[model samples]
Target: MTIRQRLNKQSICILMLILLMMIVTACKSDSENVEQGINDLEADSEQLNPSEEEEGPFIPEGKVQSPFNGKWIPKEAANKRPIALQINNSLAAYPQSGIAQADILYETLAEGNITRLMAVFHVYDSEKIGPIRSARHYFLDMAANHDAVYMHYGGSPQAYSYIQQTKAPNLDGLSWLDGIVCWRDPERRAIPRMLEHSVYTNQKHLEDGWERRELRKELKENFSSGLEFVKEGEEIIPWGQRADYVTVPFSASYTSSFDFDAETKKYVKYQSGNYHLDEEINEPLMFTNLILQRTKIHLIPGDTEGRREVAVIGSGTGYFISSGRAVAIEWQKSNHGTATEYIEKKSGKPIQLNPGKTYIGILPQNLEVSFQKKAINQ
Candidate 1:
């Protein structure tokens, strides 16, 4: 072959090799770009959908939020029916047991200008619950509103008649389950007070009694307390006046008060001129919500013991105090089978309570409730 032809062939071969190298480099760049694109997509996915641990604490399965207090609890516990005990509030029964654990506490006038408490409990396993007293008819209405099992030592004639009419599931300390589920406290009996104030019950005894009675242990399907709660980390400032301290007078002789603690954002309860405490724990009773409901309460027409009848199945005005603030509210109850609805007067919306215990005072219409921006002692 000629030298020129040989040189041309060598040039062509060199050109082909150079073309192959360029193609390989371009392919390598494309492969790297594809890999980088995939990495970017993965990063975007991670940003959009964080892991469970990154969002918040992991909650175990079979847990649900409690309707009573808006706290997380086991589904089983949340589904169980609440228990309402007619706790004696006589001065002699100071520092009642297991009352601090109550999800809801109710104060109303009993006979002889004395006040009584109906403590409603859920998600609790208290060893001791009372100094249980006799039930008043109105308390049964409240208990039925919560779908709770009622417990009392004995009841007024009106209360017994109402129980029979409603067929409410109740345990009576004066009945067949006296020795089995309730007994007179030896320590209390040793005191000089009447034997009526000595009756007490505990969790274990109540549970056994419930089982024996074959009462429904679970709450009714789709049951709601008609209580709304603020979301976590949400701040709700009421438009009403500040209430650092509140005083509720159920009767001329009986008064209940609360002092707000800014640090804990809860109200420290004071009753009978002292801090109310649960004797079992010796801790002062506190609450996160306070509701003073005004209702028509009057003495039964011909009752010998001065048993009072409370009008609970009606609408009324009230005050709701929480987070060191007070707001006027309206409450309505359609019937005994329904829960009370508390609506803010300003917004005309159902008031949302802070997550914790609540104290309700069913005051008479004529009573004058008062609150101040500062503590009374301060």
Candidate 2:
């Protein structure tokens, strides 16, 4: 062969080999780039979004909010006024029929040493409520605050007078007295509370009563509860001292205590050394917030039963308990019609409750209220 031909062949071979090497190199580089890119993407994703455990609870969906609890309620229910029910809390009233459904519960002395409850039912549809008792005049103050339709068997002369003066919408069992709005549950295996404790109210009568009375069903204007709230699932309470247990003795025979449960972030209610359970749910009612108010409770001159008259509409001192913490608070009201605003003693801001049901307990000004973080309550 000629020398030139040999040289050309050698050059062609070298060029082909060079091209093949370049192709292989390029392929390897692409593979490495893809692997590096995948690693980078994964690292970025981990940094941006962590596991749910590291994060908090899922944000609640829906815009409709309850002015009562500040939780999401149905749009239909949001504007509706709550039902303020006067519930008996006597020993005969053990295992209250429907109080667990209350958005807010007011525990106060009605008459005697016995404490009574006025449960303002909102966002809950309880089938049967109450061996309903009579209403005390101060209860009207709370009832009017929420614009709730007051429910009771009977009322004191003061209460009846207040009801007439305010022109408040009310449902009285005394008008029907078990004939329509309420009933006597003869099968209730409670202590012989006589025919009195047997009275129970159902939803059917309430619907009927409202339609008959032609009262305002839903709110027309924007209404606020004037409460502050922290984000949900947060255990940190901005105000208040950490307390494991809070006890408020209403009287010698009747004292109620609340034990905070860290697991549920709720307070389990105990009254007279027993857990206050609901008859229907068979569960002790729990509250997210417990308010202890020491106010000027007076004796009504003509009230033969010694029905207590709590001066709830005036400025007073109270303790707001939630999330195992208690804060000193001041409660004030412009009038009986306005909600008693609970102000943080230090911040001067309206007391914000944990995001759930709340219980407000009003004691006589002289009653000793205590809170402790000891191991016995823990």
Candidate 3:
């Protein structure tokens, strides 16, 4: 217990004190980090709670009824009333009795609330008429087999026209949801006297006819002009002078789903070549590959009153005819003259759609998309 021993003890005490102070500082730093994290979490919570102004897609009070409520159609609900009323009302400039071709389409459409559907029509070549002898294929096969959003079929104008002639089960009389023959009209669009025909069942006639050369160039340059010829409230117009007519049903919706540059490499839904990554990702229900819906709009022959003819436009191909624009979940390779490509449902103004062969998916209502690994958990 001399001076050296005393000095050693003092050094040990100082070392212990230093270690204790270091421990306290570390604890304080960890505590501060935890508190900051808690505060950040609280801020996020406050931001997410919907404000008075925001309203999500909450199912309203009372049991809502539509044709698309459950899985497939319930038996009792079959043979439901004709939806021609819904179709006619939607297309007429203002409701009118002249649109009397109701109750002709189908027997039962599930329920009074049937809102969604997957309609498949046959496409027959113009020359053939018999069902089996018909090309016996589906138009928009690429779309129907997969998603089923588009109002697609595989057949010729002859097939559809033949269907009209035979009065098929639920799809005989001309309604807005049926397929049409894409015929051309010279006076229809202001092209020329001889070159005014469309390419429905007369491809051979068109090619051989003197009008074909001029019309081909015109169609290539202005195939979209047909869309413009259709006035704001113009119902379905007749096909040239024939009793038959070309139709544009309001049953189709078009949209593309592609975003290769995204880090996730998923099919970006709703957003096309236009949305910013941050905006789409941050938005509610934002994801890729979800099916979009569309309404079916049919163009048909117009009733003539002397020189002025009146066409009927109906939209009863009920697919998500719910809160917003109806949902259209598929796109066909051949959508040149379809309604979904040319007009917006809410405004009826023409929208710039993806040209060429592209998958067209649409949700009629203003929709926000979400991703589900499997079917979305209820």
Candidate 4:
């Protein structure tokens, strides 16, 4: 063959080889895309958002802003029977600071007209009972007389997690009487075990301090991105307590059972209240009013500590005077101890009854009253 003919033939063969390679590559790419599409279809529903597929109940968006706006009545006209006391001297004997005042109030209130009272304390880092005991015993003694007692704390979840895993000695004191917990905040706290669906932090962990930031992180890392949380409920089953009744900010749709989708790492809210083996179950959290005065009871909002704030609602469940027409004896704080006491102080005077305007600062000691009666006049 001539040189020009040979060159032309070589170019034709090369062109055919290139065409065959392009066809093979195109087929491989098409197959990959088809398989990917099918996997994507099976991974999630057709909708772009998983939240849209979520069908059950969810946390609310806002806190209870206004409580007891029109609910309160004037003190003078309030049905002032004796204060219902839940805390007493037996439960709170440490400080003796408010004991005198508590005795005076107890003596003054007529029999059958007294309230059952309880006291609470908030101690930071209650690691060991040294200086903290001064505060702890005081409240414990005060709460001795009330219907119930509570102690609150706010701490990093890491510390809590360590306690939970190790089961420290101090933890034994708090694991079961009325416990209330707020989820740890994610910004500052971490809870790894709670990431699963329906798994409850062991009840042995009812210690009061719950960092809010840690809870958010655990939930976000485990759940979807759009999950929004508000104060779900005030009645958190702290690592060790129980309540006679629990109220929620919103009613829960899931009652008890839980199933986890391991592939998606999603917690499926179950409707039954039983925790099944190999299933993660979470307790329904109770939403508490941040301002506290908006609660069912008409009193100031306060934490487990003696530090008081101006609240239009009651902090937790306790004795309250709604409309100032009913004298419901509830728990209050005192200067002496951490438990509830029944003593009320008005410029050193034993308050015969809890008026609608009882200043939490002056409330003598956490006192408990036994029997309470509404004024017959009302």
Worst 10 residues of 1 by lDDT: 369-378
Local accuracy of candidate 4 as per-residue lDDT tens digits, 232-301: 2211111212222212111122122122223422222211232211111123211111101122212223
Tens-digit lDDT track for model 3 on 163-240?
355322222212332223223232423544322111122223212331322221111221221112211112222111
My TM-score estimates for the predictions, one after another, are 0.83, 0.81, 0.22, 0.21
Q: How does model 3 fare in lDDT? A: 0.26
The runs of at least 3 residues in candidate 1 whose Cα sits more than 4 Å from the true structure, single-residue gaps closed, are: 1-62, 232-235, 373-378
Cα error, residue 157 of model 4, in Å, equals: 48
Q: Cα lDDT of all candidates, in order?
A: 0.87, 0.80, 0.26, 0.25
Candidates sorted on lDDT, descending:
1, 2, 3, 4
Top-scoring candidate (TM-score): 1
* Cα lDDT of model 1 by residue, 39-140, tens digit: 999999999999877785445688776788766688878788998999999987776898888999999999987999999888888888888999898999
Strongest candidate by lDDT: 1
lDDT of 2 at 217: 86
Which residue pairs in candidate 1 collide? none
TM-score for model 3? 0.22
